[model samples]
Target: MKKVFTIIVLWVAVVGSMTAAEPVKLLTYNIKGHGMTDSRLDDIAAVINAQTPDIVALQEVDNRTFIGIKHDYLSELAQATGMHSSFFALVGSYYGVGLLSKTEPLSVQTQSFDPSDTSKDKEARGFLIAEFEDFYFISTHYSLNADDRDTATAWAINFARKSDKTVFIAGDFNAQPTYRAMVTFKNNGFSILNNTSAYTFPADGPTSCIDMIISYCSELGQEYDVAETGVVTSVNGLTLSDVSDHLPVYVVIDPIEESGVNNATETREMRLVRTSGGFSLSSLQAESMVNLYAMDGTLVDSHWVDNGEEVCFPASCRNGLYLVQVKNGYQNSTFKYILNH
Candidate 1:
């Protein structure tokens, strides 16, 4: 009997490890074409190497354009960092956005924006979608004009809604948090992964927050939890401001595993509702271990609760985004909630 119990324990451990998912690190930067000189390429590559990101999205890259130094910026950067490269031209096959990955993407696609709705004075813009094993990574740059930004936001959201897998959209949006484009993303079930409080523009002396990373998962109760995120101000004692006008933003995401439970059924059975003071859970089928976490993966509270129980935030808790996870022997579910006074 002792030997049989020992064997059972080992089997459970193996199964648990198999079901666990790995975290993915993503970086987004707007490297102005003027800053891509031969001398500065090493500094930019060093910053990327220090981060060790699995994938990178870049904007304003040049590809042997006569207007610039006649150098392929994307190719040189990829060679320096030992990564595969893909570019989509937004301006006459010369200047555009690009993507670099440690592993080659399974597929690539591009969408061109229609300039009909945009102002005549604004330039054309578009996005690139790189499909990997588990998710789609989109690279984009929005117009500086408010109306143009609004049109681009609507187009991107429509594309994301058609995807069946998790989607990550990152770029220099050229709009602040208070802009309508940002609000549309929030209202359409997308979550901002980077720290919005950290300003990323005019890298020399930043004052406004324009660069951003946002994510969306098609399933209702399924979402990627943010493990870590920040704006890269400096790397290896080299100030990044010397490399570009916009700082790079990165986010590490923990993908939720979909193995042992019926996600569609389990999510439908559980509900999270907000009340006047706090939140409450209803329709729970079993005794659950409830855990609440802040946006940065900090466990704010944990406790055991039965059906129709209320979970109150600590008085010191500020107004921000929070996650609620409820787990039991047979089922597990997670939900996102925002607290506002």
Candidate 2:
């Protein structure tokens, strides 16, 4: 009887590890590139690799511009990451949104919304819908205008509802959680996966979780789970947002059929040297004004320091995400780091 009980316990543990609750990683990045250099593409690809995501939703892309990579970004990223690819040129063949997937999607389509009632100056926006083996993976970018964001999301929600397949959507919403589109989405049975206060804009220092993910599994409540949602901060020691204005937002979705509970994960500590004296900046050869901003883009504090000097936050400073900007009269550099309380 004792041997049988031990065997049962071991079997359960092994099954749990292989459960669908281990979400396939998904990432959304706005890679700011109406015209990007090859070196820039490499930098962006490096950042995406650090996370090892299962799929990625990318925007602000330029595909094969004359002076650009001279190759479709979808193909470039596929080559860079060894993923399959697709694209929707919202403006033209050169500029639009794209997707990179580790597995071949069953079907793919891009839908452009009718903005007849929207502002004329508003840019044309679209969404990418790729039918994966398990779910409908979607992507969109909302308008900078609050009202337009509502209109765009309304269209996207309508598109998503057209099919009953489990839907996983991601993009740069431009509207925060408090906004109307977001409110409507929440009310209409959509769940923001990484819907935390973690901001992901102005990569120099994010203040809003604009880049986001939303998921809807018809049986999610009964047989599925969203394991984790977060912002991807850095690659190597260099900061993102320095390359593009927005950081990557990610989500992990797991399926749970048996009686199961959510698994908690530890927060990843960013690799930067720090102490009680506050964190020190990397070596620079210039005297600079080291300005710090809260995740919401609020200027928390600033200091004048010589090159390679260590700057400290106030004693009253609380813990969260903060961005560091080092400016000399001649040139400026930005760095983003975390402050643990």
Q: Pick the candidate with the highest lDDT.
A: 1
TM-score of each: 0.71, 0.67
Tens-place lDDT per residue, model 2, 154-223, is 7766766666567878898887776888878866767666634667888897887788887654433232
Write down the TM-score for model 1. Answer: 0.71
lDDT of each: 0.78, 0.71
Lowest summed lDDT across 10 adjacent residues in model 2 is found at 263-272
- How large an RMSD does model 1 have? 9.7
Clashing pairs in 2: 20-255, 21-254, 206-295, 207-295, 207-296, 223-256
The segments of candidate 1 whose C-alpha lies over 4 angstroms from its true place after superposition are 1-20, 64-69, 116-121, 220-222, 259-341
Please write out the lDDT profile of model 1 over residues 1-341, one tens digit for every residue. Answer: 99999999999999987766688899998988654677677788888888999999999887663445567878999999999999998887778888999989999999877565536635678889899877889998888777777777888788778888888888888888768998788777676666666679999988988888888777533456566667788887687777888999887776765656646445434556554456655445455899989999999999876533357888778899999998977568999989887
